[model samples]
Target: MAVALITGSAGLIGSEAVDSLVARGFDVVGIDNDMRRRFFGDDASTSWQKSELERRHGRRYVHEAIDIRDADALMTLFDRYGDSIRVIIHTAAQPSHDWAAREPFTDFSVNATGTLNMLEACRTHCPDAVFVFTSTNKVYGDTPNRLPLIEQDTRWEIDPGHPFAEGIDESMSIDQSTHSLFGASKVAADVLVQEYGRYFGMRTGVFRGGCLTGPHHSGTMLHGFLAYLMKCTVTGTPYRVFGYKGKQVRDNIHSADLVSAFHAFIDAPHAGEVYNMGGSRFSHCSMLEAIALCQEIAGRPLSWSYEEQNRVGDHIWYVSDIGKFRRHYPAWVQQYDLTALLRDIHDQNVERWHAGATR
Candidate 1:
């Protein structure tokens, strides 16, 4: 059986990628240090990801709890599994944009240095493996916002003359950015992955993602926007909308869609290519709009509050232009629209939390 190794396999994006890989009949190996638990306290949990994957797919997902920064351990895993491993979906990173400054060195180590470790391990142990990296739209920085925005009922957007209102294409400028420390670190990883592909003839690709959400997300207010909204709505937790008068727009794509893109890249390895992966033009929503949609899906009113100040380096508008990937994997078009996505996530949050309350 062909094996695929996934770093951060217990994370929201990583876990979903694993499930998708297993369903597609790949022997999957996952590695994580459960740093989320350390980072977010008890609220950070990944056990459900493992248990649920087992129950649903009947695949005993092999996992190793090791920090990827430990080069020896990462190389050892690759050495052991190199024979069957054909792909590496590099998804592990320090993801909080606002918090990266508080722990800059740690963020740099995980996001940039750890990626270097993984890439080197692949070079030594599985030189032929395809590497698919999960990058962020933040890498484009704040330039997209300067393109001339017009506010609608729920979100801020560019006027028609401005080309990117539909979404941002790969050609968009990444120079003018205020993406905080998190974006800086990720950009380092993104560029390094490309350098490896360019200099060493490795098949590496980057997926610049927008808001990626699914059932397994341990959503916090600062990150995991869709999951946080769904959880807040269902649990009646206060949902705070920050900045732009709750009109900041973002495109939310399910992790399943992202996994499909990852699989496509693996199946057809193209060296150092980058593609934006997320909801297309039609799948975007503003903060207030999303809240209203979640309310409709949950059949209840969410206790909502807002503060005017924005999070540091938070982009006012970011929707990915997936036209490039669409051309490559036309069949991999989004399976869930925004409404269906909201409903599915709402039900999952309700079921999981209610079960927890009962237990």
Candidate 2:
């Protein structure tokens, strides 16, 4: 049986990948230990999503509560699947910068060494399987903050004449900037993915993504920006804005849209291909703008306060240039913009938020 193996299988991206791969008729094996609960608290746990995936897909979806950091366990899993596994999507990571500082070893072991284990397994067993990594734009670190920006009422805008005004492309350097502890670990993993393809000749692709959000995201204040903001709006939970006078900008992409891009790459696998993937200019907003949109869409006011001290290594402005990915996969289209995206999140999870509140 053709199989699709996904790490972080219960996360926003991994769960979405599970649904997509399973629908396309692949037996899916998922690896997750719900470490998010450790990183952020019970509120950010993905256990519910794990159960939902099993309930929805039944025998087709197999959930393994395996930690990717466990090399021997991963090796065994890969050997069992062998050449039958057609694709490996690695979306699992300690996703927050603040959390990384608290536990550097845990972050590095999972993000860097964990990736190595996956690559080694792919090399030893399913050498032909396409490996896709969900890398973060934070790899560029605070470098994006160096852009020429104008402070608007609710947002920071790049000069229209600026080369990157359209969006930041793959040309931007990932070095010589202050990457947070989390970003540093991801960089190690990102480079390793590229090296595996370039050196070992594996079919691997790296996607340097912006804010990847969706209705399924177990959003926490520490990560999952748009999703968490919407949750606070819907539930009347207090939210806090950090840094840049709440005008720091970011781009958002829905999980389904990103998974579609993965399909395009998997259908036509490439070696060591890296793309800057996100909503780009089409779906970007500053913190204030996002708060406003969340409140409007959720039909509730968000209780929020701004902190003068911004999070260390946070970007003041970032919008991805997806031209490269589009140029490669012309048929792939981005379906969600900010309003449509927030609306989708609100529509899908309003009841869940309300339920959590009543309980």
Candidate 3:
């Protein structure tokens, strides 16, 4: 049996990936320390993920409460799995862009140094394994803003006359803007994952994704935009839009789509290859667009307020050019577009919150 090891297995992306892997017949092991709750002082939704996995898939899911920073613990997990491990999906990291400012070093330790530990552990214990990393569009920084933008009634966008109404491709420069602390740390991790592939001949691939969202998300007011918006709409909490007239655009890919990409990458492994993974032009939407989606999905208008101040490093418009990935994996297509995706989240949050409401 093919063994797949996933770090950050309790996270939105990781947990969804686990379900995807098991359905495809991979014996999966998940590891997480739930540090997100510890760091943010908010409820972590991972407990449901674990319980759901067991309930749905029986005993197929194995879990470890292991922090990636602890090299010994990581190695011990690797050692136990040993030769059975065919793929190592590194989804663990300090994922928040806002918190990186408050705690840059801790971000570095987890996003950069912690990634190095995973690579080193793989090198030591699972040399022949395929390593897949989840990187961010933030690595491209705000340089895209320098490109001429056209203001529409609802949002700002790259000039339609430019080569890509399709969206920004991988060749777009990442060096011009001052990447925020979170971007820098992720860039460090991104480069090293490539280096491991280039220098050590490990089969490694990096996916610099835009907004990755799903129902399993641990939504917060500051991040996980779609999830937070859904939560507020469902629970009657207030929601805020930070800047750019609440029309800043982003392309969102569901966690299930990302898992499909992983399966595609593993089937046709690429070494040191990086691609932009997200909803393309077809899946892109603005904050106002998203709020409208939420309103439509919930059958009521959202209780949201607007704020004019922009967050540091926030982009006015961000969308991925998925042509490269499409060309490579023609069979792999997005299962959910923006409307359908938001509806799923809205429905899930409604059910989850209602269940709690009854309790």
> Which candidate has the top score in lDDT?
2
Off by over 4 Å in 2: 357-359
What does candidate 1's lDDT look like per residue over 1-359, in tens digits?
A: 78889998988889888888887788888888777665555566666576666566565478778798999998888888875888889888888876688899989999999999999999998888899999999888777768788888778887877677578899987776787889889999999999999999899999999988887788776668888778877777788887889999889888887888787788887898889988877578888889889888888898988898987778888888899888877777688778878877777678876555310
Cα lDDT tens digits for candidate 2, 123-150: 9999999999999999999998888899
Cα displacement (angstroms), candidate 3, residue 11, comes to 1.3
Model 1 residue 288 distance off true place after TM-score fit, in angstroms: 0.5
Over 1-359, each residue of candidate 3 has an lDDT whose tens digit, in order, gives 68999988888889898898898899899888778776655555466676777677777888888888888988888888887889989998887778899999899999998999999989998889999999999998888777788889988888888886678899987786877899999999999999999999999999999999988887777668888787777777789889889989999998888889998999898888899998877678999988888877887778889889988777888889988888888998789899888877877678777565310
TM-score of each candidate structure, all chains considered together: 0.95, 0.99, 0.96
List candidate 3 stretches off by more than 4 Å. Answer: 357-359
> How badly does each model clash, as a count of residue pairs?
0, 0, 0
Residue 244's lDDT within candidate 3 is 89
Better of 2 and 3 by lDDT: 2
Candidate number with the higher lDDT (1 or 3): 3
| Best model per TM-score | 2
CA lDDT scores, all candidates in order: 0.83, 0.93, 0.85
TM-score of 1: 0.95
Candidate 3 local distance difference test against the native: 0.85
**Candidate 1 ranges beyond 4 A from true positions:** 54-60, 357-359
Question: Model 1, 331: alpha-carbon shift in Å?
Answer: 3.0
